[model samples]
Target: MSPLRPEELQALLHAAVDDLRPAPDGYERIRAGIDRRRRWRVPAYAAGGAVLAALAALAFFAISPRSHTEVVEPASPVTGQLGSGALAPTASRTASPPVIGPALSPSLSSKGGPTGATATGSATPSTPAPAGSPTVTPTRRAENSSPATVAKDGDIDGDGVVDPDISYNGTALVVTLSHNHQTRAVTLAGVVTPLHYTVTDLDDDGRGEILVEVSGAGGVTTYDVVRLQPDGSLRALSKGPLPLVVGASSSSGAGFSCSGGLVQVRSGTSDDGTTYQVTTTSWRLSGVTFAPVGKATTTSYDTTSSAADPFTARCGTL
Candidate 1:
């Protein structure tokens, strides 16, 4: 349809308002409107089809497949809470650093070897681990208290030769010997328990002897001596002149002694019922036996209750 010229539009407007009362500035308003349309409105309406075509082209381009994709990289790991001071995002995977524990010192393993640490992160050998070397410690404490032990290994016989080892483990039934390797022992009968043992050169001889104390009847300790023979065997020495084996020493000082470079035994009695006469008998080593050597007597006469020298001194002069 053809757009109307200014004159035609004016004529139509006048006819429309013919019987209406004109406004004070209504004609001026009409004149201004016509001028505006002549400059802008007429051109816009005439080219309406071109304007619509241009808009359609722009819309097609906007919806077309894009050359590059808008890839939003993932937000970095949040080391801290939202409100907390968060470290700035970084491209590195490790971010800050691994939370490594303090370095630990080498510790002893059960077999007394240094236990080494293992690779953790990425299996790097020297990488500080989340936990360093194990903080384990091996205790070197003795858990069990040992029983009494007796072991003396050297020249055990008077001959200038070393023989089997001799040892007594307190209450054991046998005396442990090293060479025969515990094959020889003093399995004394009627024995309760072994109390103690001694090893020394008993006769001023170059060899050593074993003095064993065995518990006897009524808890009385019987002391016995044994020698290691040159034949690698043991022989119980007949206690020279003393009563069958008993005691380190009698209550009255009657016991065995090698104090004078000779093996001897002492025996004594208060003779009278009231301790008037003290007769002490003595013996010296005779070959492999002990024979009586004479006796010494001590007499107390003044009092009926009686008096006598101590048993130890009874044989002191002899």
Candidate 2:
């Protein structure tokens, strides 16, 4: 081996020294990278803290109870219709209209028997009805010595002839007796008028009785029985503006007739070419009162054709 020159030896020494120098500042680069990551972590940590605070605030309000306050409003008025075809305005409950009908009297009785119209010039004689026709039997009442006794063939004054005169005084009916020349006035209450009269032998005693029919409100008719006294006086046998039939409360007109010791009441009602009804009530005299014995009713309707629809019902002895 030859001895190395100084320059070559120095060059080899410099190369070895260059190779031995520390790797280019690796710890400084790692420290710079760590500093950059710390900067980004600060912002992320701040955003995460803000989001947690917002979530806590939302949870706190969601569980709170709400207020319960009532809001009341006033009721308004309303127009309502009643059962009787009337309209009423009210603030609360609607009112019901009054019922339109005749009041039944306690003194009168309803019974059944054969029916016949009173003898009238316009009335046609009908065949004797079968048993159980609309008729009422009278109840016996105690007899009294009244001037006008309710019996057939009664001449209270012992007069053989039965004569009585009737006249109207606007508000009442004036009855004049022939035997004693006595006069009696009968007045009606509330829109009632004396219509006409009929005579019949009610008790079959050969004496004549008078039946007076009067018109009243709502097209209702009333009947009154009067006996002719021998002393020229009149006695009322029954108290009645009685209804015509069992089911009829009102009527446009009424007719009465006495035959075979029975009195019959007939009433008829008609609508405007649409419907019609007819009813008959039979009554018998007992003492001073006439009792209903039988009743019959018939109803008819008009269809689109010429034929009429009819319905009929009978009750009591009829």
Candidate 3:
């Protein structure tokens, strides 16, 4: 009883109100007030959130850097270790620069000069020249002829000036000589369409003679013996007829033999059978002409025989 329990008093009041009916207008007014307050508070909260979002967006843009469109470059060819991992870089494969130096040729000083060469490698051909050197342009010759080729170079006439000897100029044998400071060239007479020639001393006079193989009128092959004349001209010593030396056999001595101061021609008056009876005739050159020297000799030979041949030897069908 001390303070009459507060709980007892509250229960009494709730019981009294429980039986009483509340006013319907009062409930309706309370509902309307609650609705108005809720509507206003919802709009205020939405507005505050929208402002904060806008401020955040402005701050982010101001602090961030501007974006740029970048360009990419193409990669170069890379060759190196492949299967290990990434590709390895390597040096460029471009060619090296050409070497600049002097080119040596026949008669040409190593300092870049003219040339002379043979296809048989007995001579040297042309090659690329060095810088600042005089260029020697090549010219094409006629199909029927060869270019002026140097066979030997020396004074044949003994006039002092070194002669540039061109043995065969495509069609003929020429000897260019310098006499008394005058230069002269003679294309040997009776010598035509020279194919090639050899320098030899046939007379043993201590002088060289040019033996040329020429094309004859009837397409027959002819040989010419060319000698340097006293008047600085070239003359054919064997203009009459080149020695006939064919059908040569070891069994029979040479059909034609050339010795010091003498030349011989042989023939077999055979009926074109074996065991040819060969006859040899001898002659000597006398002032650019051939003169008979010794008596004619006849000898029998078995063609299968071998002997020391003096010159190109031949007997009819031997």
Candidate 4:
């Protein structure tokens, strides 16, 4: 083989290139034809899709379960009437009446029957008394009915003695006796002013003494226990001053009285305070002096202060 020259090889390549044809724009042309076909069928494809969706919805509705709905109507006025097509309403029940009998007259009941009156006239009505008629009689109380005398002592003067002064109607009555040495009589009258006195056997000598409360001016009051001497004279066994003082204008004084050998003296104050109260229980025996054994003093004071009013000084036997 001989080595070919450069000119001969170049001529052979040019003749091969000239014999080959161009691709004739085949890929672009095929793409354009495909687009035109799709454009023509787009409406028909859309219509087919809509028909399929409609068929599926119809099938689902035909097979699905359904709920029942009831219709209610308004009640008619003739609902409870017989033969009505609607349901008959219940009827309201009523109660029966109570049994009774004929009333029996009073005159008819007098005859012999169960409702008749008894032979004792039980059915007869009672007659009432007339108005202003007296139903009860006025009782008569006894007059001049004197109180029974318990004990009595005589006092010649208006003193607080059972002998001379008598207590009647809460007042002491003084009795006076006049004698002609043969016959004696007495006159009694309420004492103008009653003075209280106490009698007691203070000395224990079997003889009782009288104690009287006396008040003077300037807050001075005295309790005098006087014993009746055998010589017809009165002697003071004990004398003491009062612990209370009353105003000069006030009608205040001490009162003494004795009963069963016990002596009590009461004193009043001028103002509204505790009235003087003195109680003597026991006494001492001396030749002439009679003293209180036990004495208690109680006083009432004014509302302003605790100061007690002047009262009788309480002292025992010396």
TM-score of each: 0.34, 0.35, 0.39, 0.24
In TM-score terms, which candidate is top? 3
Clashes within 3 Å, all models in order: 1, 25, 5, 21
By how many angstroms RMSD does model 3 differ from the true structure?
32.3
Candidate 1 local distance difference test against the native:
0.37
Query: For each candidate, C-alpha RMSD in Å?
Result: 36.6, 30.9, 32.3, 46.9
Candidate 1, residues 70-142: lDDT per residue as tens digits?
A: 2222222222211222212222122211112121111101111112211111121223433323221111111
lDDT of 2 by residue, 1-318 (tens): 989999999999998787676768889989999999999999999999999999998887676533222221222222222123221122111111001111110110111100111111111112333333322111121122232222222122212222223455676566543334456665632212323444445654434565555444553445456664434345666443242222223223345555667766655676554344546667776555677776565544343447522221111111
- The parts of candidate 2 lying over 4 Å away from their true place are 1-164, 169-172, 180-195, 229-233, 237-254, 267-277, 294-318
The ten-residue window of minimal lDDT in model 2 covers: 97-106
Q: Which scores better on TM-score, 1 or 4?
A: 1
Off by over 4 Å in 3: 1-164, 177-185, 188-194, 216-221, 238-255, 308-318
What lDDT would each prediction earn against the true structure? 0.37, 0.40, 0.42, 0.32
TM-score, cand. 4: 0.24
State in Å the error of residue 263, model 4: 2.7
Looking at model 1, residue 73 earns an lDDT score of: 29
